[model samples]
Target: MAKVSISLDAELVVEVMVLAGVGSPQDAIEAVVRDYIARGHRTEARTELKDEALRELDAKPQEPQG
Candidate 1:
């Protein structure tokens, strides 16, 4: 594992620790980081799909309505 140093609000850190029922700051930090990374991946995938749909739309010609 890698060691990273990040500064967070003291109150926010305490809240996360209490909610997670974790004794150490590291455990709370790890849980938050993991959730953030997972959500990021999901967002990226959605963005890519949206872009692809836009491209397909742009490639299609509009049809005239009677």
Candidate 2:
């Protein structure tokens, strides 16, 4: 995998380390990025499902009632 450098606030780094249970800020960031990427797939799947539902609704004919 490729590597990149990022600058984060000191407090935010500390928070990430604690939340991720990682030794360093870099490890915490890596864990967060991996989790985000994995969760993003689920998010896209949900969006597609919602769009399909909207499309189905649009395609349905309206009923006339008195």
Q: List the residue pairs that clash in candidate 2.
A: none
Model 2 over residues 1-66: C-alpha lDDT tens digits? 787887889999899999989988888988998899989999999999999999999999979878
Q: Which regions of candidate 1 are displaced past 4 Å?
A: 6-9, 63-66
* Residue-level lDDT for 58 in candidate 1: 93
Clashing pairs in 1: none
Stretches > 4 Å off in candidate 2: 63-66
Candidate 1 residues 12-46, lDDT tens each?
A: 99999998888898899889888999999999999
Per-candidate TM equals 0.70, 0.68
Instruction: Assess each prediction's global lDDT (C-alpha) against the native.
Output: 0.93, 0.92
Q: Specify the highest-TM-score model's number.
A: 1
Q: Which ten residues in a row have the lowest lDDT in candidate 1?
A: 1-10
Measured on C-alpha atoms, candidate 2 has an lDDT of 0.92
